[model samples]
Target: MTKKDDIVQGEGTKSGGLSRRGFLGATALAGIGGATGLGSLVMTRESFAAAAEEARNNYVVHPGELDEYYGFWSGGHSGEVRVMGVPSMRELMRIPVFNVDSATGWGITNESKDVLGHDNTFLNGDAHHPHVSMTDGRYDGKYLFINDKANTRVARIRLDIMKCDKITTVPNVQAIHGLRLQKVPKTNYVFCNAEYVIPHPNEGSDMENMENHFTMFNAIDAETMEVAFQVIVDGNLDNTDADYTGRYACSTCYNSEKALDLAGTMRNDRDWAVVFHIERIEKAVKDGSYKTIGDSKVPVLDGRKGSDFTRYIPVPKNPHGLNTSPDGKYFMAAGKLSPTVTIIAIDKLDDLFAGNLNEERDVVVGEPELGLGPLHTTFDGRGNAYTTLFIDSQVAKWNIEDAIRHYNGEQVDYLRQKLDVHYQPGHNHASLTESRDADGKWLVVLSKFSKDRFLPVGPLHPENDQLIDISGEEMKLVHDGPTFAEPHDCILVRRDQIQTKKIYERDDPFFASAREQAEKDGITLEADNKVIRDGNKVRVYMTSIAPQFMLTEFKVKQGDEVTVYVTNLDTIEDVTHGFCMVNHGVSMEISPQQTASVTFTADKPGVHWYYCNWFCHALHMEMVGRMLVEKA
Candidate 1:
């Protein structure tokens, strides 16, 4: 056939001709079907150019080009921090913190058990808020702190190493929901707020009467991660929502004193924003009298009783988010139960405290109605704020100054625009621009549901993170990323600002680099995995290689406290090993050529299998040993 005839076959063409039917047959032979079997259809140049532009916009990556921004999101109920690349919306890493990770053997090795801080009371974690380290009121890219809602602890993840280096489990605190790292004026502390109220240390008070009481942990020594002190917040303090650290130094002079807390109740019990004066609270802790809840004495900060120092301002119903502008002139909060985003003048707070203005009369400075169920609010350096609406599944952009002026009878437009997200959106993080002159460009909306948005794997669906472009006049929904677990909040920073460490030195204490140190610590690779029994304590020292644990069997009494020290024999990085004692609630990571230890009381007498969880070799599944505990 002629070439022109073969190229433009219409109807009644011969066999093997380039007609529509022949093209369809060819595509069928190549296994192309359904909507994708459109090779037979002709496309216009304009349509092709549009499709090519979309493909280019959604391009995964260049050969060696790094992402422009880094996103650190909280892995709720997973007890880990998920790291992703912005604009690209690609998941890069998952740092195990306060959780059991079989991939990296976290909490499954001796060293990681210490990192997990497991005790007689077995517990997992639900990470809620992930806050990036800030310096001078902006992301410093040095560390990220996340709070475990289930276990009531805080983990400090070193950005350089991309791993959790420190975990501070506070005593006498329960349901820690909010964590804020103070950095604007260089106050080295992380403020953690508890949701539910518990009795003072060693007290068994009735929860009904104690519902008004709350505890806040003062995690000092940010460089070292330590709980310097604990303070009592006496009020009908609802589940504390997000906190904001003001940029300007207040009367207290320290940046920590000006921390504003959104005292919100999930049950919509009260509507008040509590302004904490850290300096006064610190003084009360130094010379404050204790009050007895039931039997234990707690330093309760009751402003009515002159025991604490905190001022309250009435806001809308059920405020879920609170943030300060870049200039520290205004504080914004979103009421999930109400559609309005309330903006409170920071300077007017002093008037409210001085009794010049009453909450019922003049509490709210500016209340601009936005959308249904606003949960979080983030700022771009330019007088604008973006808030997430859960019920509406959208983000509303508004001008902070316009909201303030609207309340002053200027009749200005506070809401600039709104962009729809997939499913139910929860919290959001904008590109780092929480400064007076920052030009907020992008926003990542963390949603709660992703039904029918991606391929279904099981009953539990992955959450969706929608990337929105806000550089133009109107907000644009650009991309959708699927996240497996429930993500609560995220923090974004420029890629160039981050400096991560590729690997840790072999001699690190968490992963002993030298055999001499392991030997000096009584952890030896003796033949048969020597077990030392002394009274109620039993210690086993063994070494691990690929697909095998040198000591395959262990025996202990039901009441005995068992300590297993496992060392990795391999010298290559990433060829790590893990020890997980099934049903005993014991796990640890033994890094390559490193040693780690895990200790637990074998209170139950049963047969258990301990295995390597790092997936190091083909026979990694068989790298298990028998563990038996007999009745004492």
Candidate 2:
């Protein structure tokens, strides 16, 4: 018997009601010369450029800014979670992930109970951190989908109740690092990126037979709780082909020996004969890079053949996060290895699949201004996009519609400029929400690290410190208190209430103070924030409502050493409170009923929130608050 027949018989080829040798030969033929043929048919750059220009000429202005919300929720190392409020850019809330002990100030209480419940329950050896989160406004406007990487499970959280419910386990997968939800009118599919798998050590001896596999895609039926389809991007092709009465060839090396072995055994079977040699040719072509060919070489099943999949667009490296545009016209993917955001036109997917074999359809956004390292990104209601810069500990914004217009040939240099950069060093995941306070104006809530922390700059600049500042043209700092500890993941608490206010009414105090300081420093404070209409400035304060009692409010003119006084008014025992200003870099813990004061300098204006580091607070989900700072 030939080498292929020997291996097939050794593995009991027909025991499972399938002929292994026949299947391997067929697959080899289908994959040969497939990708190369696809690549040669793509549109040239000049054609794409002309098409882009034509698209702009026919473009019609949108009536109003897009009205969809984007959220970023990250897990923390110390069990603290935070969400960023986009556009306005502020902290929505910070909640504890574990319960703390009152006596020893060590050992969290009920360590298994996550703030969101069963869905967020701590695994056998797991701890709370902002691991993964998703949002589906259709299910419920105030609900968020989250996954605990440590536990390898998915769950749902209700923003209104701050509670979580465990969902079904994502089937046929392990180590889900990133996931995307595709809504197909009547059906919704969740595509999960599974763990990387290397070939078994023993397979190296038979390099031609060794297999390295990654879960290409898994289709889950949300309604039936069934795994509808599973595709292995890389696998032992013989296993699949055998069942189909086809032949497959080794993908590791291009040679006739492997092909001849299978062909000799399956020659008597017409179905097997057609499959074996065909697959061998395909495999030779794919593995050899089409450098050499023989008479046995045959065409393979390439999606790009005779299609428009030839166009190439750049995609970020190690894409771990993904989201689609509100209008479903665009899709965005975030890279983990490098700082890069890729935008893809969804309408082109079919064309991409048709001819662009080995080509990725995507465009790089904000490449020139900021170094790429985006971990997660979400869209705000006003056509702007927000992304978290993991390495920089900062959040960046982009105008999607403006970006598309630029990609499609519109020229707007200012829109191309990167306007806002909020530096919250050591920051992780974040989310955005739009709500109205008592004043009847839209408020952006951002959640982030509330501890006195610092990230290393590098060996050369070891002392370089970073802090997230939420102050900008369309952003401001509002309120703050002790409600977080190494805080990470957060999402906006969306509500239906609407409120409107005169813009200047919110800017007078900060503008006036900034103007005074700028004049003293021999600099001019720009006539911004409508200073004349409402007054010269605005008053901004933060209130904390957990672990103890405190309402910290102060004017920007007071300098950075703002004092916060705490009183123990609640009946709860052993409950202590503390406040830490991240940007100012100072913290103090206050005991119950006794007024204690802490002071820190606010050198920069941005959104900062505090959380209770004490135990037994994660269950309440009330250990944090919001603070907004402006140019003072």
Candidate 3:
């Protein structure tokens, strides 16, 4: 055989024919040529420039211009809110909210429980609807509000630290889906609604012949971020979707009288967009005509006592989203099973609320057909509304100018242009301005499935977020961000407008005081690690020191109430520890020099072990303790 043939076939020794280095060099040259040639190859200067431009746009971030806007996205069942930078399309941070995130020791940390706190009955949650605080209807960038549907709670995340500050439970509510911030008409309360039907307040009713009421909407205070008042409604309040506050507080309702069968599907004819006259409820509160219920003493509005506080505007299919215009002249709603978006004039609602129109029927204005399964609508300040089509995986841009014209009886159809997205899209939100107007520069489309769009990530595919450039006439797909878990909803605010801090003060009581100084200040940091038993109440102050828990064992009797106060003795920064008791639904974090506590009832007798879940030191696994509970 020839020398080249022998070398290629590996029939010749390295010394007899081609050396290893020479063979590798020859193969690399041939491989490069073959790669460039391909089956049929073509390259041009224009093509090269276009390719280079696309790469630069996708990866490059100019200095001093970090990010134009910040998009707060819900992490769904992952129980967190993902903070992403727009334009750059970079994930800035993941703020843990309604779940036990072991990576950051969020729920595992003791002090973090003040934020992760919820009913012991629920260990996790489906976090949805990340609504930022508004000032005069504009994104204030101070506080962000998100709802936990699974746990039935609302959490307030302070933007300064990018951490959850407080989590308030919604008593007697099955699921919380609709959450929105309202600042207009002089009230600054975050509106939260129960998505599912439950029995009337204090009724002790069951599913069989249960009196279905919409229940009270817990209006959480903006400053304190607590559930302040509840606006109770009387009806078979089915699932409520995206809500807004403009001329009146409005929410889209699904499957009340129009039950979508046993499978809980969407119906095209029975859904509605309901408006609540919040002022009437405020008057009821002023007149002291409200009743309190449950341990929280949540005020409930007697549906039988007041004039009708709710007005229903019947729309097609299951309306999943509602968005008011920047001018507050109109509000748009799209149904999940319908092909159209119903646009209602705010003035018509005022007329209805004034009792000028009949209250027996739903107020219908205009139903402009957009696309199949239109799920959400967000307006651009440029007089256009973008609606996401879930089934079609496309976003339809409709003209609100034409919608208003059509409402004025001028024959103008509203659907303008439809842009294609990656997969099944859920919710789409646009960047807002001072007047709560959509900036029209960028629109984020959250899609559900990502079968072949990204790398094959096994059975559980990464969620796809399509960043679209809507600055020009045509919507251009700018970038694709692969995200973990399902992102249900998102809201955008300017990055420069909001402020965030990286570290807490070293002397701050909750997160910063030194362990030695705190103990000296008389906060009860006893080294003996005593479990004080007062009758059935057991109090244990557990301290952390590097590789071991100071209190290694907790001896308690069953049916005893146990309150464990956890304290961290570490003086070093970022050396936080977490505490989690298995199967007891107790988890919390203790920062350096800080103390946090968790309380639970030791109802069953068994030997249970608790450990530090935070991955800090090398001997983190060794920081464990045991709880021995004897039968009562």
Candidate 4:
């Protein structure tokens, strides 16, 4: 089937808009047949692309509002949600809520109606301490589904009224983390991962085994809120108890008592799973030097799938967030507690069922050398993929098309070498929403987790535990303003598009004069600014102001080559800055008082933020400027 056809099948629509069929396609099955035969499992590349295309059309690509950008804040003690406005990075709104244990994850259901006077879910409950990992899906744009860590229940929230409709408890589920809505035929189902669950030896025994049976996928019905199918992921089991005990012990076994302490005590003597690196344990076994003793090696119990769960895979850690590309051609999974993201060709899904999946087919993406942690991920319009970092509190943007192009040997490097890395400390779970500027260019917004530091008040407080700026090469600290105490999530809002005739007829004659003066001064134009209309075009000049930091802005018209001279100005604080236009295809960094120049034609016009690229400097928050580009 063609991509267009797949859209019809997956989204259940002929027109490129939301329909009952589109809702079904997004929530129900892509086609009628189930995964019964080998032919059904083996999907050709063309068919997969079609399915992805159909899924893409269901979403309405609205222009983003600069003022409606939603962000979450958690200051060690309390938490609130804040909306940031454009033109100026000011806080537009703040909804304060007290006693929030920890804001794990959040999602905006497209219900359009208000719930609890709010559309977002805080993911807190009575029995559980409100640990929500991730949330997704808006069936008929009314119901919001979230996975709760503390309760292991999938909370179905009514978005129109903004109230908790019902919480469906997943039986035998423990430490549930990520929740995703997968559309089957007629009904929409939820696929979730039960990260870890404690299994007792007999009944009320003190000993607990960190069982692998917890990692299973569940299919849920959206309308009725019922579970359709439950599938356990078990790869292979080769070695006997001795080999597994010595090799995979760290990955599997954990003291149930210790887990309770960290997570806080639970009601039912339930055992909590311990977190560890499984790949390291496997290496020790392969070398034949794995230590086996009463304490060294724990007994391996048969999981739900028998030995399938205990099998070893090339990827070294526990997989956390799992998602498919918009095109459904690739499946991506991240290793929990480790900084690696793995991409698997979906065509290989059948291998898992055949018991012949190869570890070499998986490509692991990581920057272990740089201490970056890859956590939750979401896709944007231009086929680019963005992943969040739990440890560093930053976002990494990867070019999926380029990665695939390089994988296909089309080019040695497929990415434009232009990376727009943004820094938002404590940035944990994130989602993407696209919007267009008055000029019709696409922009993406990122939500982050910003919280206040929890300081120890005793005399024994470590002096070495001071705050350090380490944003690294890709991202610079832009604004350290007190706008946020703890930002947990963010969503991009597109502003309404401005007509061409209205832009030229605006009352601001100063903007037009600035363009004429810059040209009369014998300055060559480079590009137009997106947020500002000082003039149609401005002259490019270079200056050296700060060491390893660049200070620059733009001037532009409807159509003209604009030049921006960037200089490194030496400021009072130790900070580095760089300039980049991700969509316009321009960027460079300069040293303090040093200068660099880049020229690019303003082919695409939109509002984009250019900020500092280095992690140094205390007032790093003050390093932000905007550009507004008009049509030529």
Residue-level lDDT tens digits of model 4 in 29-75: 22222321212422333443453344334332345634322222222
Off by over 4 Å in 4: 1-140, 183-187, 200-202, 209-216, 227-314, 335-340, 351-371, 389-393, 405-411, 414-632
Count of clashing residue pairs in every prediction: 10, 82, 7, 82
lDDT of 2 by residue, 333-388 (tens): 55544565556555554444444434433323333123345655555445556665
TM for every model, in the order presented, reads 0.72, 0.40, 0.73, 0.40
Which candidate comes out best when scored by lDDT?
A: 3
Top model by TM-score, which number?
3
Superior candidate under lDDT, 1 versus 3 = 3
Look at candidate 2 and tell me the lDDT of residue 619: 44
lDDT of 1 by residue, 18-89 (tens): 444334433332232123342332222233234435544764567667788888889988888989987777
Deviating ranges (above 4 Å) for candidate 1: 1-60, 118-120, 198-226, 229-270, 287-300, 303-308, 348-364, 433-439, 506-594, 598-632
C-alpha lDDT score of every prediction, in listed order: 0.65, 0.34, 0.69, 0.36
Alpha-carbon RMSD to native, per candidate = 11.7, 25.2, 12.4, 26.5
State residue 190's C-alpha deviation in candidate 4, in Å: 2.5
Those runs of model 3 whose alpha carbons end farther than 4 Å from true positions after fitting are 1-59, 62-65, 118-121, 185-187, 201-206, 210-216, 234-247, 258-268, 293-296, 302-306, 358-365, 407-413, 433-437, 506-632
